[model samples]
Target: MRSLARCCARNERRRHDCKEYRRAVVTYYLGIDAGGSHCRCRLVDSDRQVIGQGESGPANARIGVEALKATLMFACNQAIAQAGLSEGDVARIDAGFGIAGIGRPGIKEQLAQLDFPFRSVRYETDAFIANLGAHQGADGAILVIGTGSIAHVRVDGRSFSIGGYGFPISDEGSGAALGLSAMRHALRALDGRTKPTPLSAAVTGRFDHDTTLAVAWMDQATPRDYASFAPLVMDYADAGDSIARSIVEDAALHVERFIEAVFERGAPRCALAGGLSHRMRPWLRQKTVERLVEPLGDPLDGALLLAGSP
Candidate 1:
């Protein structure tokens, strides 16, 4: 009986030690979704349980590497603090980032050189992560119309994309695009080249009807700056303003084209995502509207998947 008791005690000790070992070896992951307007971070444990969340300002790569880094770190530090973790724990965390402008030339290379506090780090375009989250890593496509626009599809382990070149060049269905259209119409109205509708008058009113002031604002405007006008355009459209309706309808046509292109690439499913998606949906053709699916997850979830968190 004494020998049996000893064996049972030893076995219990072994089990306790094993539990401690497992706890000590558990990993943590940080997922970041950085866009033209905001930076968001999520922290999770190895079991895929949320530890904390944080958000900060824009982290667009075009904003300059130092500023981008500052934005990212500010959000990350908040998440770490919320998780009750110290800065030292950063060295043990794996990180995944889905950032706007990452696909631009030299941006990825510049980011790769940063000394981030993580055990591992990976980067991908925001559109790619949105698609991954939308479909839960399954084969699918996503059309993102936010401050910028992009179409991305993944099929059979391969990825293809359309649009999202950037503001002024591409992003056809984006908020910035709508704002740009409004600005042009407003300018035309100011020059007496077009009839000044409520939309045009409202746009011009922002500059106090001064074309010179409008031009000066344009000279310093970034995509986010232009996107600020999108809500006003959308509001005017809903109120039956002809110029606003025209601008929205034109942008919707671009959205339709992007959706068709994604389907043409053999994506079995497609989702419309981003801040402007909800507003844009009501403007889409019925047939196009019927085809979009609700996303299964969000970009932060996709970023976590990229981090290889269990």
Candidate 2:
């Protein structure tokens, strides 16, 4: 009886060892969706099963290579730790990144020059990954309205984009643009050029209603700083603030135009994506709203797909 029990115990031990060996041999993939507002990291095994996820602050390429690298590493490390792995495992993991501002001149080259700790790495624009994830790499269009906004389409094996040229000059209908408009309205109210509403008053109140202080803040403000006011504008608009409503309406008009252009370019379906997509939807035209479809997946899924791509 004792001999039979020992044989059964040894068989169970072998099975456990085999299971651990199989797990150890499985390849890991890491996907990163780094955007203007935040960076997300996802770790998956060869079977595409998610093991861990991590998030960090903005990782826009415009922030510079070193800073972007640091942000990516922090998120990756967090994901690794969550998966019961260590930093050394990064070298064995394949990585894919969809990063904002990657289309700017020299940015891609700059990123390639960095010594990333991955078995291999693939890079694409954040919009690209979002579109890819939305349609599962099928032909479709996506308009991402986060801190910045851009429209991307994939049709007939060709890809194109509209807007997303960065803040101040481009990125129409973006959070930064909305905030900038709000700030301008607030300043105009202070100058008596426009009537004060709750929205403008709220904006000016942030600076104590002092024009000098507001100017100081603008002089040093980045796109993220301006974008911070977008939620406030949306809130006030929802509460029946006319000026805020106008601002959002105008922004939504631009978004609608982008969607129309995407369809005109031959995209069969479009997905509204990003942080502000929901807020902007109610303000868009019924025609535009009718054309929208739910995305099949998120940017992180696209990033993982890229990680396994040739």
Candidate 3:
């Protein structure tokens, strides 16, 4: 019987096919969000199940290429082990990364040329991915106020950046911005140019009251140092200090202006994010409220979603 013989041949072929014979061939995609502070890596299956996860510290390229590579390897190896597979086990893989301090021109090219194991890889600024994560891939804007501040938005398949120009002269409406403002007030009071306030007392203690301290402090103050002073401004504001209230108010206005710029690009909604966003929301009055969008998930979780995308 030709039909019976053909069926037997088909069965034999299937039996001999390693791929077909394998009962469990798992597939996964990996997503990484790396920053100067920490890096998170996640692996997810088609179902969006978090099959694996890993974490490392300071994987930023600014820290050095060796540090970044080691961090990536450490995280990926942990994820691979958690998924019960080696890098070679996955049938198909895609990767997406959101990296901080990577907006420099040559960085993307460097990352593109990087040799890594994956089926496909896409790398973008953390701000872009944060924009995607906040809005669930919808076209909109995000206001990030943390140790630094930045406005990133996407519309018409293009990205625009506002603020986040580092600290002092730029980072308007950020913690650092407010801190610098506070320091200015303190210095004016110390120099007898303005009435002494609680801020003056606070600043003297912080700067150790060294002569010519303002000059040296300005030169040496990191973004985090300025951000650290943000709480002082908030405290004074709550205590009904006019100057502190105005400082925070100024921060709010700066953020609002940042959002307005993004909205001008045809973005229908804006999402407020970052450490300061939580407190900053209440500071936004009627206008910014109407334009803002609710976040879909946190950044690390967002990476997982991308990992599972078809």
Candidate 4:
């Protein structure tokens, strides 16, 4: 009986030690979805269960490396704290970041070499991960229409992009573009060069209906600032304002062209993403509608998958 009792005690001790060892080897992951408007962080434990989430201000690459770093850290630390972990634990995590403007000249190289707190970090374009999440790692395409716009197609391990050149020159169907068009019409109305509609009056009124004042505002405005006026455009369009209708129709046509380009590239299906995706759906072409598929996940989910990559 004494020998049997001794064996039972020894087995219990071994089981406890084994559990401790397993715990010691467990890993954690962090996923960051950093866009022009905001930076978001999601933390998960070894089992892939979510621990916490946090958000902060914009982290666009154009904001430069130092500002981006500070916002990213702020968001990550918020998530870590919510997960009941100290900042020191950041060193033990693996991370993945999906950032806007990641494909611009030298942007990827700079981000890849950052002194991140994580043990390992991977980086991808926001559009790429949105494609990954939309199709759940399958062959598909995504049109991201936000403050800016871009389309990405993934097929058989190959990927391609369309539009998304940037503000003013590209991103034709994006919010910034729509807002810019609205402001232009408003300026023309103020100069008595165009028929002033309710939409133009309302838009110009924001700048006290003065051309000089509007120009002053534009001189310092960012993409997000322009995008802020998009909702007003949408509202005016919904109310059947002709000028607003024209701007929206033009944007819709651009979106149609983008989708047509995606299908032409051999994507099996496509999903629309970003702040304006759902709102723009009613304006999409029938052929584009036929090829649309519901996303299995979102960019954040794709980012998390990258975080756990071997």
Q: How many residue pairs clash (N, CA or C atoms closer than 3 angstroms) in each of the candidate models, in the order given?
A: 0, 0, 1, 0
How many residue pairs clash in model 3? Answer: 1
Q: Looking at model 4, report the run of 10 residues with the lowest lDDT sum.
A: 83-92
User: lDDT tens string, model 2, 1-310?
Assistant: 9999999999999999998787667678999999998999999977787888999999999889999999998999888889987555666789989999999899999999999878899999999999999999899999999999999999999998888999999988999999999999989988999999999999999999999999999999988899999999999999999899999989988999999999999999999999999999999888779899999999998898888832
Error of 2 at 254 (Å): 0.3
Q: Which whole-number lDDT from 0 to 100 does residue 151 have in model 1?
A: 91
What TM-score would you give candidate 4 relative to the actual structure?
0.92
RMSD of candidate 4 to true structure, Å: 2.9
Error of 4 at 224 (Å): 0.5
Model 4 misses residue 173 by how many Å? 0.7
Q: What is the lDDT of candidate 4?
A: 0.87
The candidate maximizing TM-score is: 2
Instruction: Mark the 10 consecutive residues where model 1 has the least summed lDDT.
Output: 83-92
Q: Find the 10 residues in a row with the least total lDDT in model 2.
A: 84-93
Q: Per-residue CA lDDT of candidate 1, range 121-188, in tens? A: 99998888898889889999999999999999999888977899889999998999999999999999
Error of 4 at 144 (Å): 0.3
In candidate 3, what are the lDDT values of residues 182-233, reduced to their tens digit?
8888787777887767866687667676548767887876666777788888
Using lDDT as the measure, what is the rank order of every candidate, best first? 2, 1, 4, 3
Please, what is the TM-score per model? Answer: 0.92, 0.96, 0.77, 0.92
Better of 1 and 3 by TM-score: 1
Q: What lDDT score is found at residue 209 in candidate 2?
A: 95
The runs of at least 3 residues in candidate 2 whose Cα sits more than 4 Å from the true structure, single-residue gaps closed, are 86-88
Q: lDDT (CA) for every model shown?
A: 0.92, 0.92, 0.74, 0.87
